[model samples]
Target chain A: MNSVLTIDSAIVDAIVAHARRDHPDEACGVVAGAIGSDLPTRHIAMDNAARSMTFYEFDSMEHLRVWREMDDSDEEPVVIYHSHTATEAYPSRTDVSFAGEPGAHYLLVSTREPDSEEIRSFRIVDGVVTEEKVNIVDATVDA
Target chain B: MAIEVRVPTILRSYTGGSKIVEGAGDTLSGLLDDLDAKHSGLKGRLITPEGGLHRFVNIYVNDEDVRFLGALDAKLNDGDSITILPAVAGGALGFAAAAAFFGR
Candidate 1:
């Protein structure tokens, strides 16, 4: 049995496109969807906060809500995605120390360099982190 | 085998777009020094001019982050992989937690 990562091109693209769309500053949001086993990864959209774009801080309740929805749907929180407008695509100390959520993959999109798409993914657990490749596929969302 | 330091996209320009680099050092700081030798500005980005890893940047030895260990001095095995991650996500949940607590 292989644990292959399934991601929608539309989903990851929407996130990366959001970052590129709002270039020169960080763009971020939570990916709400069921993870694994033929789930559409659907009804998934980027949640925008009015606070700021240069940086994003997920709302705990929102975070909890997403997790609960995934659980209720028999899904797992697959990935946590973010963009770096001015910095590299690695996990910052804040990212590692404050992950709070385990087993979920962290995806970083780089928008600092324009005219090209720069994105990377990682699996972080118990402070031991490993890199994973992003597989983008076109996904159909259930409205 | 050498410890492979995975470079993030934001810091790649320092290494001329080189993503992975090898170091023969046994400590995280030593690896940084080796990287700095090849890419000078990298050290400035990861650490302050004062030689401290910026609050936003983190170095991980294999799966164990150096911060929880000895930080820069954290020991590494021959096959360890060091990952550099930067924190720049939006809507950090910290403020949200405070708002929820005070019902603000």
Candidate 2:
């Protein structure tokens, strides 16, 4: 599978905003896209049920509902994103171990620094985390 | 009649390379017990001898982490999805470091 993630600029901004807003606490969410297209279009910022600074867990019912909706719409989570309040934009050991989607890109945004935010994407499969290319494009250029 | 448990690639060895398997139980722990019967060595990877979920292992019931619910006792229903994965962290590497690892 291609390891690169192509996302909308607006979505990136929204994710960053959410991360900043949740500062000190980790923010988690998902971006859904047309099945097999790999083009992320829908952004769904999820509730970190854990509400812990060091960990994040999506609300169970909400996750089920969102996943089912995506299934009905013939879409899938293209990107699974979360923020690191004081750490770097990287999947922690727990993150790597919890990554269940071999097809989804795991995006991490570090809000540790007030002036500069670090964002990165990766593909975590079989316990290995591999960084991927992130290309941001305008959302209005679609045919 | 059975809940679908999605297996991660790393743990597929115990499942005979199957990505999805059926386990019968009303709670997360029960299901794992059922899975243990069929796929030996799998439960050990997920549950510690202390009966708690392995710290590095995260089990999600319908996309929610079981740890937040009831851990091993989380309730389950038929058709509910369970996903098991191993946690690992990455992303702090600079472009050069990532390139060295991913060779991109």
Candidate 3:
């Protein structure tokens, strides 16, 4: 797997917007791309079933629908993102223990600061968390 | 009765990279046992040592969550389809807080 996440700047903006909108409650979603393709193209914002400021869970039925859609489209969840309402942009013990997608980029957005946000990404596999670089590319610019 | 079971990416290792595997049983628990016989250790991943569904693993029978269908006791048919998915969950809560909240 690549050591960095190269995502569109627009998707970053959308994720930040989602975090801000959910504010005290954690927001969660996924960015899907073609299977085996590290590139993320589709941003899907999911409901936080827990709806707690300190926790987030994708609704089960929604997760099923999203997974089915991705299966039909030959896409995989390239990025799985959630917000930390009162902490830094890092995966906590809970996140590590529940990290099931070995190939996904686990993105954490911290909305603790009222005026600014912190964004970071990591690859969590087998209970190991390895931080990765996030490369935001301009949509209109050529890669 | 042959039933098709869809394995998620993480659990694909247990299925030997096979996305879909076939098993036969009259109930969800029995079906898991049947698959475990061929796949080896696959059943432990879905069911805990206490014989309950793992908290983070989700199993569905024909699009309906097995939790609502008597979980392990859920009845199965000859051609029913089963899909297994790991729950997508986490939080900013620290280990202690998370354990307390989840009753773990």
Candidate 4:
């Protein structure tokens, strides 16, 4: 499996925007892609069930519907992402423990600063998280 | 009734290396009991001695975290998907090297 995460610049913008919009509260979402493609195309911003600045949880019913739709479309969760409001972009112990996707990239965006946003990606397998490089490209390049 | 349970890689050893297992129970706790009966030592890893879920373990039914739903007593329905994962805590320190979890 590739260790680097390649995504479109537009998606990155959207994620950052969401994180910024939800300042003080963490934002969570997923990027669905075709099976075996490793390309994240669909950006699904999820509600932070916890709605806390320190934590995030997806609404159960929403998660079920979205997952079922992905299954029906033969798509998989290519990227599972969330934001850190005041802290840096890093997976917490809770995040690592909750990671169920060994093949999907776990992306973290930090909106700690007013003008700067930091984004990073990782692969969590068997509770072991490894940082990976994120390559942002123009959407047309991937299309 | 049969329920589909998704097991994480670290805990798959107790499930005979199977990522998915069959379980039957009306509630989340009952389902866990059923799983433990089939795969010994599995319950201890998920629940603590106090009868509550482990701090590092997370259980989700049908993609929703049981903690928000009803925790150990979360009701289970036939064909529900239950997923178990270990909580990795790290975002406390700054962003650098944040992905590398400190304590197991």
Which sequence of candidate numbers ranks them by lDDT, best first? 3, 4, 2, 1
How high is each candidate's TM-score? 0.49, 0.70, 0.96, 0.74
2 versus 4: better lDDT goes to: 4
Residues A1-143 of candidate 4 have per-residue lDDT tens digits of 89899999988888888988888888888899998999999999988776777777676567767766887898988888888888878777767766767778999999889999899999988778899999998863332
lDDT of 2 by residue, A1-143 (tens): 88688888899999999999987888899999999999888889998776767767676567667766887899988889999888888787667656777789999999999998898999988879899999988873231
Model 4 regions more than 4 Å off = A140-143, B1-20, B54-104
Off by over 4 Å in 2: A140-143, B1-21, B25-30, B39-42, B54-104
Candidate 1's residue-wise lDDT over B1-103, tens digit each? 4888877555777878786888767777777887789888788877766666665455666655576778777877798887775532332234444234323
Q: Which model scores highest in DockQ?
A: 3
The global C-alpha lDDT for each of the candidates, from Candidate 1 onward, is 0.61, 0.79, 0.92, 0.80
Q: Which regions in candidate 3 have their CA more than 4 angstroms from the true location?
A: A140-143, B99-104
Scored on chain A only, each candidate's TM-score is 0.75, 0.96, 0.97, 0.96
**Residue A96 of model 1, lDDT score:** 57
TM-score of 1: 0.49
lDDT of 1 by residue, A1-143 (tens): 12335577777767777788766655665554554453336434344343344455544334435544665776755567777676778776545554534545677777767776677777666566677766666645532
The 10 consecutive residues of candidate 3 chain B with the worst lDDT sum are B95-104
Candidate with maximal TM-score: 3
State in Å the error of residue B29, model 2: 4.6
Candidate 2 residue-wise lDDT at A116: 85
lDDT of 3 by residue, A3-101 (tens): 999999999999999999998999999999999989998999999988899989888889999999999999999999999999999999999988999
